[model samples]
Target: MIRRLTALAAAGVLGLSGASATASAAGGPPLFTDGHGLTVVSRPAWVDGNERTFVFTVRTAQVPAYSVMEGQVSGEHTIMVTLPEGYDRVATRYPVQYHLHGHPDRPNTVVNQRMFEETTVGVPLITVAPNGSGRGWYTNWRYPPAALGPQNWENFHLDQVIPFVDANLRTIARRDGRAVSGHSMGGFGAFHYAEHRPDLFAYVGSFSGGLDLLSQEQRAAVIASTQLPGSGTPTVPVESVFGPPIWPLDGGWNRESPAQHVGPLRGMGVAMYTGNGGDLTVDPLQAVVENRAWATNIVTRDHLVAAGIPHTFVDYGDGSGWAEGCTGKHAQPSCLIADMDHFVDLLMGTLTHP
Candidate 1:
């Protein structure tokens, strides 16, 4: 499916040639570096309703050093920061939540797109959005560098990005000050990062993550053969992103699968928050091939039946939109804002309580 999207994008590039290519080029303002030579960018403060949006450009030197991205070079990361409104410079400590974006396939999607503006605004917390490599899984691929090898996405977020944010910003820099969440692929990223770095985050949420990345056998079936539907097949990119000894690479997948890592997460007292597409658009064939993405919460709820991990799952079919049956139809921002209100209330209520 990624290859198909990339191909379509390539085809669009071939046809349009000039406009569409640069329209969403995902590249923005020149890369800025911190005092430590870490590439960083701070955006003009955006004062919104109850939050301020600040952006950051993360340093990418550590990714290639860790051999994570196969061919990822240093000094090539972009991140965005959004904080609660009326932010004060006097505040020496504040909570930070790193947010990741979904794929329309842009390098700096965290800043380029507005798909998740509603989620961060007015949340009373600082938000960070780091750019994931195009079509890169938010995972550290086990395979060594080769053709289309890996993107070192996990290390990019954990090692470079988070440290940079903590160092530059006046943040609490603790597990409690840290929260991670995202929409779609970003959602998966949130869970994966939280699961791996339990010592760093007390709260984790996923808004429609492509969590089914755990189904390696199924993906292999799709990648190894070209009989799949809805997209073109490219074994090279798939192999590179997921890593090899293909076919049954559940180990690499399990590293990021929230379901597989549920035991440790619950043990670590990591709060889990997850949601799915109520009436919104989601890829088909989700149930057959990749069920874990949506079902993780359900399984999580059941698995944590005895354990007391804070968890919330919401579906937006309550008929709250202005002019419609579907809440997502006309005023998505309004509808999503309402949803965010409810979710935020739930999150604050749980996390703040003893």
Candidate 2:
């Protein structure tokens, strides 16, 4: 039978374990909670058998409320966590791996945790996967202010979610204690977070991610993501998150692309994976997507080399990831699992995962 715990943060009260020092022993106080005003209102509910869950509150509500007086639930976000096996049985702190999901997605316990937990079986680490918003782009919106509700995903993840996790959980609570990884768009998010705040993470990995946000093809691809198939409806209303994807304003694009900012990743462990025109699972077009990702990653890999930042780059060509029952090489499970297997190994080598 499944067990349920009492609501820790009951009735809007911040119910965190004030005595985690006892549980974590040598592990220091929570890093992101003291100063950060985040509240944990409930206990975790893992939809999947492996991963646990946590629903916390953010100070600023990025998305507006549907009904004015009702308030916004987006302010109260969900971050599903996968604790080390025997977490309840042991009293120790562990390193955290923040896994980001792709576009048109939410923080899913099953979809995200399955690959991570399966690959890291017996490994002592925590996997925290937060709701990054469908088509959130994982960046602050740069244009179309009126139509889209306040879109500030970067601030939500960096300023709020990261700290909140550090606050409530028995984490290592430092740069060396944390790592970030993502698939497809989340892949972009992982690198973006690592590149922007190199101090917060010790390792970064991207599986079939869009590292070059400045590429014209990538820019157009994002535009296409906003619309639905067949119906042509505006699914996500992503106007322009990277500032006009064209000339004039487009010049500003280089300011943030992970490929252009390799210096920040100097000492950090970096790993990336993608298929080279591999299995076009759904259709031939899927191959095009992987092909595009491969192109962007090559330039990014070269940038890392130029900056003397050592990284593992795998362009597992055609018939690589798909043969394992996955749809194909682009943004399916097989590729992400492969990425995690290699990345977790790299992370274990650097992080204090005992």
lDDT of 2 by residue, 1-354 (tens): 111223223232232355333333232222233334344443344454443333333344554311111122534555667777776666566789998988656565455667767776778788888766556667777663454466677777788777766666767777887999998888888999998899999999998888897788877777776554321223544455666566676754667688888889999999988887655555677778888988889889999988888999877777444347444457666767767877788887887555
- Please give the distance, in angstroms, between residue 267's alpha carbon in candidate 2 and its true position after superposition: 0.7
lDDT of each: 0.48, 0.68
* Root-mean-square deviation (CA) per prediction: 13.1, 7.9
Q: Which residue runs does candidate 1 get wrong by more than 4 Å?
A: 1-37, 41-51, 56-59, 63-75, 88-90, 105-123, 144-150, 212-236, 244-249, 267-292, 306-308, 317-339, 349-354
Q: What is the lDDT of residue 339 in candidate 1?
A: 39
Residue 49 of model 1: what lDDT?
38
> TM-scores of all models?
0.65, 0.81
lDDT of 2: 0.68
Candidate 1 lDDT by residue in tens digits, 268-322 = 3333333233444443343222233445555555555655565665544323432
Q: Which candidate achieves the best lDDT against the true structure? A: 2
Alpha-carbon runs more than 4 Å astray in model 2: 1-43, 48-60, 63-76, 229-239, 279-282, 319-323, 326-328
